[model samples]
Target: MKLLIYCLNYAPELTGIGKYAAEQAEWLAMHGHDVRVITSHPYYPAWRVADDHCGWRYQREQRAGVTVFRAPLWVPHTPSSIKRLLHLASFALCSLPLLAAQWRWRPEVIFLVEPPLACSPAALAFARLRHCKAWLHIQDYEVEAAFALGLLKHPWLELAASALERHALMHFDRISTISSSMLSLARRKAVPDERLVYLPNWADLAIAPSASSVALRSALGIPAHAVAALYSGNMGNKQGLEILAEAARLLAGETGIHFIFCGAGPGRALLEQRCQDLPQVHFLALQPAEQFPALLGAADIHLLPQRADAADLVLPSKLAGMLASGRPVIATAEAGTELASLVSQFGIVTPPGDAQAMVRALQALAERPARRGLFGAAGKAWAASHLDRHAVLARLESELRRLTEGGGAGTRGTTLEGLGEK
Candidate 1:
């Protein structure tokens, strides 16, 4: 099967959607399928394009048997709502020619990863033109998330965006999302039940707690006896990371408890500023892939703070790795939400942005080594059963084969008119 994946982020971006996109593409490629990815340069979780890809030029490379095309886009140093829209628009406009270039390729499946839903219309149109399967894998519901998070407040804009999103969503041959809650949202947007796929992000169950973790602890100056509460991954607005700093400050006098904020993003500067006075707090840039498992192992507790509004809008991709690392997690999520339910299974769940509650949870876990061990074991077991990378990708590959082999049951012969455009 020939598959073309359209996404805003891709490999060499240590965390978030990019890592998963790269993995999926490579996995398919390695499994004897022809996979190609059209994405922007590595500029995520940091908001700055890598120096090697820092120009407005289209570049192509072969990564792990997959062909990747990188399109240039504007990266805002600090992404506000309007700036973010412009950023997505820039990529949508710039990548059009690249999308057109794939016309001769005639891919069997045009797989799109959404966050930058700006590119949806083009992908749908091109897929329709070629009569191929248009598969949309939503990592985040950008439009709804923006509005719910108060990032885009204009009533008219919200109406327009929501209408566009629903139209695009309804026309896709298949729509997959990372969580069941998100798949339900897609169904609410009128996507048929058969078209919605629950494609959760995967975990590399091979990443066991390793001896390198001792070396990492020493390098970070984390005392052997101190409990390291680590928050590792994209430091973004949706993360509600301010609460982490506040929690760190409140626990400053607890010498045996240390806070390590690892990763990069536009929010990093503000997070650093907030943690400057807290001696027990430390910040590290995102670690390399090889060091990632050890980094997760170094943490006695993983901190996952999320904004209440973003609770159901987006599920953190980092949670899989945290669970796979056999570490107990302290996640901020509202009751009854998917995130809260998942974390509650093996760790603690606190209300979003409640610093006191987060601190209390951290203290409780830090004080009970046996309880932490039990939670860690349960988390690892859960990850192994549900998030095994090979099993997840194999299921996806089977779906792709089914879609390409004409076995999909989604509504077909969808016209441009169905998108509410003449």
Candidate 2:
């Protein structure tokens, strides 16, 4: 099968949807399918294009049997709401020619990854031109999320954005997203029940955890007596990371408890400023993929925070890795939200932006190693049973094959509700 994936982010971005999309494309190619990706130059989490990919209008590259077409895009150093719109718009406009050009490839399936939903109309057009099935895999509901998070506040603009998103979603033959709550939102938007599928993000189970990291602990100045609560991923506005800083401040006097914030993004500066006076807090850069397992293993408790408003709209991709690492998580989410419900069995959940609540949760985990161990074991078991990258990607491949083969139920069984269903 020939597969064409259209997404704003792709390989080399190293976090969020890009990493998962790259994994999907490479896995499909390795399994004897012809896969091609149309994406912008690698720029994400940091929101600045890499030096190597700069000054290029267009570029083509191949990696691991997959062909990639990179289109030029504007990257905002500080992505306010308006700048973010412009960023997505630039890519949507720039990638049109590339999308049209793919018609000659006659791909059996044209997969579109959303966040930059601005590219959807063009993706749909290309799929129509090629007489292929259009499958939209939403990594995040950008429009709704922006509105919910108060990033875009004009009433008229909100209506316009909602209309555009609804129109784009309704036209796709198959629509998939990362979480059940997100899919429920799609249903509320009037997406037909049959067309909605449940595809999920997966973790790389192949990377085994390293031996106890004495050298890493020494280099980072982590005392052998201290307990580290690590938050490792992109630092973004929607993360509600301010609460982490507040928690650090509240716990500054607890010498045995440390807070480690590791990642890059626009929000990093705010966190650094808030935590400057605290001695028990540390900041680190994003580690290479090879070092991910050990880096995760270094943490005694994982911190996964999300803004309450953006809770269900964007599921944290980092959560899978945290669970897979055999470490318990402490996340800030509302009681009824997906993150809260999902982590209830294996970790602690607190209300978003409640510094006291977060501090209390952290203190509980710090004091009770036995409770942490039980949660960690359960999380690791769950991840091992359900979050395997190969299994998740293979199931998606099977669904696409069925869709192209004119099988009986085109969208019925594609929902991966089995994952995280408990």
Candidate 3:
């Protein structure tokens, strides 16, 4: 099977959507599928490219087995609506012309990633134009995500965006999400049950932790003595790092447990400032995604905290990475979160944002290090059986194959009849 993935973020960008897209592309290529990724120049999480790729507009690169084509973009990385809209518009406009040209030359089943729903229009149109089918990968319910972050305000705009998303999902060949909750939400909004698929985040074996290093520990100033509770990923608003800070406030001056957060985001500076006044907490800025295996290998325990509102639309993408790193997760978020399920699926959950509970769990895990093995073992077992990248790409391949083969992929309406299940 030959497939093309169109997304706003891709390799070199450390955002959730970027990582997942790259992983799937790599796996499909490895499995002998002809894979191509059409994405904009790298800039995400922090919204700025690294010092090297600064002036480069567009280029083609090879990642594993995938053929990657880059396009120029002018959107700022920050969250302001004007800049975001510009960014979205730039990708959609730039991507469409190239993708349209690419289609004429080399057509394949296209997969569209949401937010920059503008991107979806072109990919969807191109698929239709080519007399082909496309699968829409819905990660977060973007409009709801914005509302969860307190960015969405106008009710009419919400309705319009909701309608647009529904139209896209209903018309697309298949719509796969990262969680059951999101699948339910997608159905409620109007996706046909058969066309809908649930493709949760999976651990990248290539990125899992290797042997622990004393040099690595010393380099980060992590003492050979202290018990470390690490949160390594985005420190964005959706993560509810403030709640983790509240947990830190409760554990302040405690000698046994320590917190190490390593990642970058719009919220990192605020997080650093929040922890500065509160001692016993350390903040490290973002590291390269390539370094994840070694960087995350050192955690004694992992923290996954989501803003209660965030759990609805945004699944903590970091959970997959954490689980893959072979460490036990200590997650606190809204009830019923798929991530929180990792804690239970592995049997180690505390209520969302409860400082006392976090402190106690921290102490217990600190005192008994062997439980980390059990947690990690469960995650590895589950991931290997269910959520590995290769498995997900296979499921994706099958779904897209069905679409290309004119198999069953029905659409649903607002009434949601026969939706959310198939």
Candidate 4:
């Protein structure tokens, strides 16, 4: 079947959403499905395009067996309401003509990855005109996140936004998201139970480095003999990075323990500014995806840090990669979250943003190599069984096919209650 995936960002963005969309498109294309991605020029977390990329109001490129449509867009710097609204408006307008151009083929499925913020309008329009199945692949819930982040402030505007979000969601033929929490949120918005699907975040085992330790140590310039505890991925308002900085300071001079903060974000510059003078802590910019496995794999402990406030909205996709890299995790999310539950089930957990607790947990594992090795094996085993890239992509493909195809066994056997129940 032909598939058109519409998202705000694509490869090179260093976002979990970009990685998820890229892997899905590539896998589908490799399986003989024609996949085309309609996306904006790559300028994410930083909100600016590459220095050397050429100008094009709109363009298309074939990358890794997928045809990608690039539309002109602006990246918002401060997350201001008006600036973000404009960014969404620009993409919404751009998709108008792009969708008109592709409406001829009427692709069998239209996949929407919401982020640039106006995907709802563009996707609903395309699916309405083409009369094709539109599937929402929600990485984050925008309005709720916007309100939580304090970007959308007016109470009346928030209500209007919620209504608009629900209206669009109801129009889609089928919907899928990364976590069960998100699925529940979607259902609460009057999404019929049968139209919603559970699609967890996934990792590509083939590309995940089997021995990331030595390679990561060499790349980061850490001595062949140093123990590294790494925290990579976005450092944002939702991530309580100050806790990591505090933990780094608390663990200073504690034999053989080094804390490395890899990846860039809004909070990274602040983290570096506050941590530059420290000897036990190191700050590094984000590496290319191919280089990430080693960086993640070589870690003595893979640390996940989140603000106590953000437990409901975001689930760091990098965790799966850490699991696939065969590293032991020291996730510090609060209780009642899927992350917290998973950590309790398979790894270590601590109160969100508790520096002293994090330090204590790291030191305990450091003192016991057997437990560290056991956790590492457990993580890899769980990841292979559930979050393996091939299995996840195939499962998604089957779900999408189920939505488009006329007949098949639906989500009856699955924990999902809504999807296929229609």
On the 0 to 100 scale, the lDDT of residue 164 in model 4 is: 75
- Compared with the true structure, what per-residue lDDT tens digits does model 2 show for residues 262-366? 899999999999999998888888877777777888888999999988978999999999888788899998998888988988889998889999999999999
Better of 1 and 4 by lDDT: 1
> Please, what is the TM-score per model?
0.96, 0.96, 0.89, 0.92
**Per-residue lDDT of 1-422 in model 1, one digit per residue for the tens?**
99999999999899999999999999999999899999999998889899778648899999999999989899999889889888989999999999999999999999999977889999999999999999999999999889888889889989888887987887888888887777667767778876766678899787766789888888878899999999998888889989998999899899999988999987889999999988888888899999898889889999999999997789999999999989899999999998998899889999998999999999999999999999999999988877889877887887788888888553322221121111
Off by over 4 Å in 4: 54-56, 206-212, 219-225, 408-422
Q: Model 3: what TM-score?
A: 0.89
Q: What is the C-alpha lDDT of each candidate?
A: 0.88, 0.85, 0.73, 0.76
Q: List the residue pairs that clash in candidate 1.
A: none
Sorting all predicted structures by TM-score, with the top scorer first, yields 2, 1, 4, 3
Q: Rank the candidates by lDDT, best first.
A: 1, 2, 4, 3
Winner of 1 and 3 under TM-score: 1
Clashing pairs in 2: 198-415
lDDT of 4 at 188: 77
Find the 10 residues in a row with the least total lDDT in model 2: 408-417
Candidate 3 lDDT: 0.73
Alpha-carbon deviation at 397 in model 3, angstroms: 2.2
